[model samples]
Target: MSKQFAFTAEQLKSFRENGYAGPFDAYDQNEMKETYKKLRAEIFDRSHAIYDLEHSSLLAGYDRHLDIDFFSRHIMRRQILDKVEGILGPNLLCWRSEMFPKYPGDEGTDWHQADTFGHASGAPQVVWPMNTDFGGAITVWTAVTDADKENGCLRFIPGTHEEMHYDETKEMKYSPEQVNKLEKNGMKSGFFGYDYRNLQKDPSWVPDDANAVSMEMKAGQFVIFWSTLMHASWPNTSSNRTRLGFTARYVPTSVRIYPDTDVINEYGSKLSLDKYGVVLVSGQDEYKHNRRLLKNARGLEFATALDELETA
Candidate 1:
């Protein structure tokens, strides 16, 4: 089953150890730009999602219903699904999807895990838009525009995916609460500057080497990563040009949705997955995609394998 494009044992090992993968370029830029321009105006409404200024959570937020728009409605469209099936396996379900845009000079987002809102199911947070083999949600981060360190690209930690999340006493949902919580826990927000202002830095953190290497992708490149990969974005210090990226999550059917608790805030959010007119992967799907993906997928760390790469 291992194909040339499938993930290598070393790549899998790295993903297992590092918690994240890729700076790999997944698609052509010109076409992606064209597709992005169309989808942005059509699906996302070109409107900024209002946030809970204090907590930063989306107030009302964008809908994850794929049926609302053509672009979103087909999250498992062949091109993407084929690749996903290759990685995670046949049985799959969507976790959620959202548009993330960092306006010029904007402080992107904070470093955090995805499941602060729920409990760990197979492995929570590490599933996939591709396949959640690692138990975390798989997120396909498609960049609509250039994502560089200057305009706030993503940062990830290696080898931190296995850490279970509990006692998130600091995962506050409002600004005041977050501030108070940070103060009480003695956490600092001083690592980088957002719009020229230094913000708070997290106390306990992720894989130490995650940020030392990062993706500087041009518009159109999509980076697929695990939700458990401790990831963050840099502040957009550029006076112009915005950074636009969106993420979609895919989960395996085997993992159950964690029951809702007030601790998560979403009152009655059930997996409610049956709602998708057609389940992308009806628990019955073989998840053959994981093996398929394993066959072709290459790990970023494997770049060191080629003697030419080292000498160049």
Candidate 2:
């Protein structure tokens, strides 16, 4: 797989050691922070409430980041997007991005899986000839507030991304309801009833030895990694601070779209993979319709903005 990308020997080696790298601080830091402050106000607003999933003080995937103005375009910058093409080649899709905010005392555990919820499709790449170039999809997350152990930073297992998955079976999966309970109540609610293969010792999903590390980036810094990276976060325990973040996912053109017919939003329309560029990126003439992204991307680029940030 390393041969497929242009990453130097060091990057390939480090990726093998940590599964991912660089909460790349590519943009101007002050602008990044200012942008996030504005977005946060919009996300937590009680009225719009489209992003508030804490039905009763728990589970808040609401007011998700995709609807935000700054991040969507920022995530697709050529400086960043070009690297995917450099590594995985032309034609790409914005699979999905997430707002994985770990607020103070907001305890939750995101189960590890290669693709979005174990592949939007029900099959694995090993059993079927389904080659999921999406697993290599890049997700960039910038911390709006400083994130550390006290505020539930992310944890990752080294070299795990290179390993093959165990055979999929009912004995090794969690139900939607069960995962909900875990989020609403915390891991103390209990572990998933299924048998997870290649299990490790870290509750955060990183390994027990030097194989694990917490992502303690500053407010303006961010990290980007493949979807298959083994990662998780802890309960936020700070006094009165909230850890906010904006994240997005990008994939090379070779991946297939796992179209979903499920209707999730108030619009009652089917949220298919088509809504994303996946339907476009995977096609032979993908860029024939690529104007949508190129049009919206006017002046975005990676520049000295990150240097103005207060590194502490």
Candidate 3:
């Protein structure tokens, strides 16, 4: 039997080999433009946000989907989950979401992969069963604006997800002063404020740029990729354009998010997970290892359709 909106066998084959897929359309251009305007304004008002930090805090982008109505709905959209379900099975949970904004003159994201997601925080953010060799979320990144090479679109090294090149247990120093000052192979890129290269298992092993593909996407389109993929972005060389990406991360219900932590420390800031809860996007959570919520911090309902789909 086949599933609607699920990836075709050919596409799944490609995803397995390339570690990424699509520039799929999730919203109409005009609709996205209007939504972008609203989101731009709404993002500045974090009065009802789950995190108790200022709007301009670096960690402010942590989980807007938990409070913003549009983001809340976006995470549960069938267009995205349908494809995600093809890989993660039916019982899925959106454990985290974050905003990546690259403005004019901003450095591109450094090439990196995340498994346990402990490189920066010194604590694992996501964990899988001991028997499983793989552990990472499926990140669906939506382009809020045109993402072209000149405007800092994402890039990936094909087939790199199976083998991790970096050690997540390594420590990285956060130095805001090194933001635009460091360059890798003459490319202007850095992972937030820290150098992602610091976590590399082999300090001398460089990424294969010859196999790197630029993922330029139009506004309202999205791409799905494994969080364990070797991904990076180009610097926004455009004089005026800003590239914005809304990343929603998903994992099977069996995976544990923030395993045993109440506080998160990363990106030179710390946040308490006092109100954090995983939004179940599809199927029922049989494991119940993580906290689940049905509503946002602002009282907006996080609609689910588990009963309407097959459970894993």
Indicate whether candidate 1 or candidate 3 has the larger TM-score. 3
Candidate that scores best on lDDT? 3
Give the Cα error of residue 38 in candidate 3, in Å. 0.9
lDDT of 1 by residue, 1-312 (tens): 334344666866665567655654555788767877676556434232212222333312233333334334345444455455556766666546666777775564555555422322222232233353345577777676899988888877665556644333232222333321121123232212211111113334332542455667887666766676666676677899788776767766654433222122331222332222213432343443321110101122111123234565
| lDDT of residue 266 for candidate 3 | 84
Instruction: List ranges where model 2 is wrong by over 4 Å.
Output: 1-9, 44-66, 108-111, 119-136, 164-210, 260-312
Please give the range of 10 consecutive residues that has the lowest summed lDDT in model 1.
291-300
**Candidate 2 lDDT, 1-312, residue by residue in tens:** 232324566865675566677665655667766777687676665452223332332224322333444654556554455444454555555645556665555653443545433332233321111554334456667676777878777777656666534222223343434432453223422123222432333334433335566788787777766656766666677877777766656655444434333223211122322223321221133333231232122233212122223342
Per-model TM values vs. the true structure: 0.62, 0.64, 0.95
Answer with 2 or 3, whichever has the higher lDDT: 3
Model 3 scores worst on lDDT over the 10 consecutive residues at 303-312
lDDT at 37, model 3: 91
| Candidate with better TM-score, 2 vs 3 | 3
Clashes of each: 40, 10, 0
Residue 252 lDDT (model 1): 68
Q: 1 in model 3: Cα distance from truth in Å?
A: 10
The runs of at least 3 residues in candidate 1 whose Cα sits more than 4 Å from the true structure, single-residue gaps closed, are 1-5, 8-10, 24-26, 44-70, 77-83, 119-134, 165-171, 176-211, 258-312
Candidate lDDT values, in order: 0.49, 0.49, 0.89
